[model samples]
Target: MTDSLHDIPAVVNREGGALDGPNSLVDARVPAPIAPSGFDLLIDVRAVSVNPVDVKIRASANGNGTDRILGWDASGVVLAAGGDTHLFRPGDEVYYAGSLDRSGSYASQQLVDERIVGRKPRTLSHAEAAALPLTGITAWESLFDKLQLTGGSNGALLVIGAAGGVGSILIQLVKALTDVTVIATASRAESRAWVEQLGADIVLDHTNPDLARQILEVAPGGVDYAFTSQSRGRMALFTQVVRPFGQIVAIDDGRDLDFSALKDKSISWHWELMFTRPRYGWNLEAQHELLNSIADMVDAGRIRSTLTRVLSPLDATRLREAHAIIETGRAIGKVVVAAER
Candidate 1:
């Protein structure tokens, strides 16, 4: 099986193409990625996922860039390994959120660091696995590392933007590992139901002005901790709902939040970036270890994959359609494009 990794890279965008950003459509061609050292894993990408970063970078590109591939999530087979690679050789079916600083998994063959990749969960198809990596990392880090929610904190958790990519996965992880009551905010009927089904104990509408009131209506008292996967527009409201000294972790960098509001409550704020470990080249193996743990959870049925829609044959047209849907801010789960069939 390891010998099968020798296959030549098939997907190429020789002219350095572009896609519509974050909620837009982009169609362009670029060059195939090159395998580098220390972290040499060439994935024969079978399926890929669109994240918020993909949308943002595409929207910002002015056609003057050269090496700007912006996909982060993928499920694929390893085509080649660097000389020092040991975690996985070749021909392994894997899923990963590749590095932020490098070209990403949008192409058919992607070069990735071995530390960041994990064997695809046994139960899911390529498309399903593609959706897990980025959101999974963000949710895992937000709940456990940043918020310190795992150390037997027998309390309630409020999750903002409960229907988005990271929130969807966060709800499930909290349900699986901890006894915390999961409270999530969703504005739409479908989104409300989606979070509840995903494992949120209670759902609130974020668009409503009476968020604090509504939360108190459900929990009666303030929440023990909060996780905000949505935008930063509601920092004030979040401060209101969190108990004194309660922890608040947000994955998105919110806008000009005055920490003064939180001072009264002694609330702690944490920022979670999934790319931190890989982006700065620190504790890289921890990524491999963390993802492998997720694999076990997924296989045990403790956590489920979050893939919602899957398109066929990675191309500019289908990629554009997926990007367009994501930009609308209505996509409930992750969308993926398969490079083959």
Candidate 2:
């Protein structure tokens, strides 16, 4: 902490409870953020993007009963670096999905590990840059790391909830890096078009009761991989539609799922949580490297930002509205709130 939290205003979840009420999140102040002694950088936060995790965290704050800042993805300029910091300097433009253990990017400034931060994509504004980190990391790890895809797999992929932020980027990455055929699930007309534009080879109405049959009609035997961006009851259906030895990956915290259904078919199930690296200090620099590569791809036009909505000068009111939009499960991509310069 830099200055006392009581000294500066910020949006916060002072009392974790249901977001249905106005008091669920409110205008509050947090201690001015400060970089620790080493391995961290202090940033002047300029923009932030919301994720479903924000809503969950707000609704389940630590039982200690103290308020906490709520943001994970942000783009900003570095203002200070710890004594041991080597990757960045004051005035550097950066973006990152911050660690789960620290103060977040919902304030005027924040502290972030330099190892997990990346140079902002040259072609994007702070608002656009903020939208990429969390989802970018999640999508990258979920596809390549968990699925172990090294390109030219010639496999077919089925993306459940394919119009969301992670799915949007995953589709682009699959299209850009491999010959894999992509079948994306999108229920709405606009979302269907969105995934198609992002390079999904086929689009199916995930709302259909016979979604597996629909995918099989187009994919022949079954898809070689399944990325379940959103599913619960549908896991069984996925097991039925995936080819033997197929891979199933997910970014969500799926509960009540039994892996036994995939036993005979030899399916491999993997879970991806982008926060794992930063939280445990495990290969933390991977985020920095991956973000840079993604930025390069963005500059080269092989990939694009998934930002779909923007609000200005982040505040509790605007944040609450963003939360509502996310909870409704209708947001097509990332929703951002940028501070006016």
Candidate 3:
């Protein structure tokens, strides 16, 4: 079915700027997407979560003047499915971190590939489930794909910025799936408590200049794996605290990282971006499988949604508010916005 004129509600960023700018993020009505084909599923978006990517993109240069719809994590119901889609039906509830190449989930409706989508956790609300996909996929990939961790693996893992979305979920995934000891860093008391509650075995203040000494006190020799959500100025720290031949994985876009610092210890550095799969079509179904696993874990009570805040009636204003919160780099857990009132 075709949409009525300007029927789909969306929040678009035009000429990216600071949150206070006139066009940073604004309410608009766009035409609904066409019928699903191939592996596509047309979704009636129920809830979406704000991530660091959204904030970064919103502040980027918009030289082309395209109105960008910036969102990744979403929980929704399938409204229709393409002929080749075998995983879901019209009424199935699902969640996914959609491709960065397409219009994202900050809208009333969206079209996503079934390969990157999964059944939503039955026990969680849409707002809660909305907080999982992007961060969940990232954490899963970082542990299994990048760090090459398995269920029987036993080692100490140091998580930097452990109170944010990915780190919060990462800690839980590690604790549930492996026997690793988690040493997480959080600069604030509430953030420290949040990570600890999520299963961190040890917590350290990220602001402390003597962090390496504290980590060494716990791990003795050094940590076996280090995951940093923000890796801008911490490469040297990882080089010092990660054991010889240990692994370091990061999700940041810091280009000034010095790889030379890691050579003396034979340390390996890896980068994880959840969009890499959908963006490259590299084993896209892996995300579908991993997300399903995460959902099962959530349903079994081994995992919990990290959703900590909810903003209602998804609109440009609320989206801008969410972006501002993320930009501060101090948000604990996840923040979601419900598409409907």
Candidate 4:
């Protein structure tokens, strides 16, 4: 660490419990990261996007009297690169949904592995690029990796909670890369419009008690695949609307889900968590490639950023506000916090 790297500004959760409004996030300074080694890149964080995982972790954190930084989706410039780092060098602009085991992007600087980082899209500002990584990766993994969708495959896909971050990008990827027809569900009129704008062929009101019936009416034989952001208590809906032997990919923790319901239809259920790659060190480089593909699609105008709101100055108060917006569960797309100019 250089002399100028002694202190770095950050927003952290001092006490790990339920959110107490603004007090839940506190402004602080942490020591500069140790010199980058191996595949690490020391980054000057330019912007960060808030995700539901950040809200969940903040609400259930246990810092043990230590400050815990909570952020994952970030876009930044590389300040320094480790000896083994080949994909990026100092001054390279990059974006990534960083690993959960490390201190996160809620700071002036962060240390991330290069294997999970991608060149930031040239057409987007730092804030816009920041919004893509986490949700984009989740959506990509759910479609291509879990649901096994391909460009040649032609079928209907049901997207539950289609107005939020993951669904916003998921809908776009499906339109851009596959022949699948999208039947997205949203309760609010604005959400329906948002999904349609993202390329949903049909939009259904998820709040409707007869949602499964409505889905079946649209895609009569049942959807070929289902992607649900909120899967708790919705297994029965998936069973009712998904075709026999179809697959369902979910991001939520639906521990109470009854797998037996799907037995009759032989419906396969898959859980997609973007963190799984870095968390267990499984095929880590795949995220790097995935983000690069997303960036290419974005630059090619095949996909667009999901950033819907931005808060300025990257302070504790702004982070708290972002958290509050996510907690409401009504965020139309992604909310970002940018560094002060």
Candidate 5:
């Protein structure tokens, strides 16, 4: 039997095109269907969402001598399953944030581990479902697994970068599942209004030099929880508004930290990397379970997909435009590419 991965059309960040700019993400074809091995599922991907990881990978692309697909979040139907796969069978509609080590989801067909995938939300289109996986997983883990927070936390929570994909979903998740007062930072008026509509109790300006003072004024005692990307150069201010014994979680890359500032208040620092489970083979099933729970939330109207923009045809040009929109640092929510039928 022919495998689904073979003979499928895909968008590739061309190898050795590191200098070619965003145009390097061209349409291409895989030479052969990659047979699924243990625990893998062969999927005919229907939709995919872009993130900063895709941009970073494309920018650093050195010729691997083959086209490198670069997308992580996708929704698709299983065309085949590995012999060891038990979570899903052929024809299952599923969604996931694919592992960082694997070829990504920007293809007509993809091979992903069954453990890391979940049944797609019945209430959502593939595009809508695709927008949730990466951001949903990150927000879920940041709140429950990393911050160990629940609906009863009732204290104030601060979210920096609250207009981006992760932040959009994070605010909704916190509002839906917790009683915490959300203070989100959005520098622009439109972004601030968007966050307000998303249920943030207060929206602060991120660019204000005395932003910490502002947050302190709003929360008074300090925020009990915060989630931010890139903690560098602003840890002192963050520490100022975070109460003693409060928690701060981050998802950015390596940066030097001055633990001494947070040390005085006994603040807990958490790092959320949604890829950690599958990257190191730890608790892969948790991702599957997490997405399932999110789907339930979506179906019940307790939450909504954060897909603010949807591009069509899924061509390289569309992808380039999507990447540009995201890079502008002004997008209020996720940008997804819906594959044409």
Candidate 6:
């Protein structure tokens, strides 16, 4: 580890508890972050976006004896690189979904692996760029990597929960690269319109049984691929709407699900966990490649940032408020906490 230049303030949880009370707030004496293994880059964090994982983990995650810092997606500048790092150097502006194994980016200074970081798109602000990494990676891997979707797929792509973080970005990705018509499910009027604005070819109400009916009216046989980013109870809906040999990819971790119901149609099931690469230390460089590729796409106008809101000051109060908004299940797009102004 290199010598510490300065200690930066960060949001921290000393006991790893709930977000409602004294447990959720800013801290002044939070230690500067460290990345002691595999690879490391000191990042001066500028902006960060909140996801359900942040709220869930903060409520339930345990820290190793010290307080646990919380954040995943960040847009920032590199300050230093560790010995094994070659992909980036000091002063490079980058964005990434950081590793779940260590301290996160809710700090002014953080250490992350170069392999999971990429240059920020020229067109986006730091907060906007910060919103893309986790959701973007999840959506991209779900469609192209997990579902194996391409331009030649024989049917439409059905996206469940089309207005949330991952779904919002996923809709845009499918619309941009694939020839497949996009069918998105959003129960609210605003969310429905949001997905359409993102280029969804059709929108259905996940709350209505008529959703399947509506989907069938447009796509008679069934969809070729289904990406579920929201409630896993919708897995049954996926079973009903996907054609034989169709693929189902879910990022939601619903429990006690019965896969036996899907046996007859031979529908394939896949779980998309964006942290898999960083978690198990497997092919860590792929995240860098993916983020860099996304930067190219964003710069080219093939995709846009999904950031819908920004909370300033990057402190615990704002972080908790952002988390509460998302937990309401009504946020139309990503919500970011910008660095101190």
User: Global lDDT of each model?
Assistant: 0.80, 0.88, 0.93, 0.92, 0.87, 0.84
Clash number for each model: 12, 2, 0, 0, 3, 0
Q: What tens-digit string does per-residue lDDT give for candidate 3 at 1-341?
A: 23477478889889777889999998888788899999999999999999989888888999898788889999999999999999999999999999989999998899999999999999999999999999999999999999999989998999999999999999999999999999999999899889989999999998999999999999999999999877888878988899999999999888878899999999999999999989899999999999999999999999999999999899998898898899888899999999764
Clashing pairs in 5: 6-32, 6-33, 16-63
Candidate 5 lDDT, tens digit per residue, 53-143? 8877787746555668889999999999999999999888999999889888888888899998999999999999999999999999999
Question: What would the TM-scores of all predictions be?
Answer: 0.90, 0.96, 0.97, 0.97, 0.94, 0.94
Please, what are the lDDT tens digits per residue for candidate 1 over residues 4-92?
34433332232322443232333444455566577688788889898887776666634654435568899999888988889897889
Residue 243 in candidate 5, Cα distance off native in Å: 0.7
Residue 77 lDDT (model 6) = 91
Candidates ranked by lDDT: 3, 4, 2, 5, 6, 1
Please give, for residues 164-259, the per-residue lDDT of candidate 4 as tens digits: 999999999999998999999999989989999999999999889999889999889999999998888888898899999999999998787889
Candidate 6 — which pairs collide?
none
Better of 2 and 6 by TM-score: 2
- Which residue window of length 10 is worst by lDDT in model 4? 1-10
Better of 2 and 3 by lDDT: 3
How far does residue 143 in candidate 4 sit from its true spot (Å)? 0.6
TM-score for candidate 1, please give it: 0.90
Task: Tell me the deviation in Å of residue 31 in model 4.
Answer: 0.4
lDDT of 4 at 267: 94
TM-score of 2: 0.96
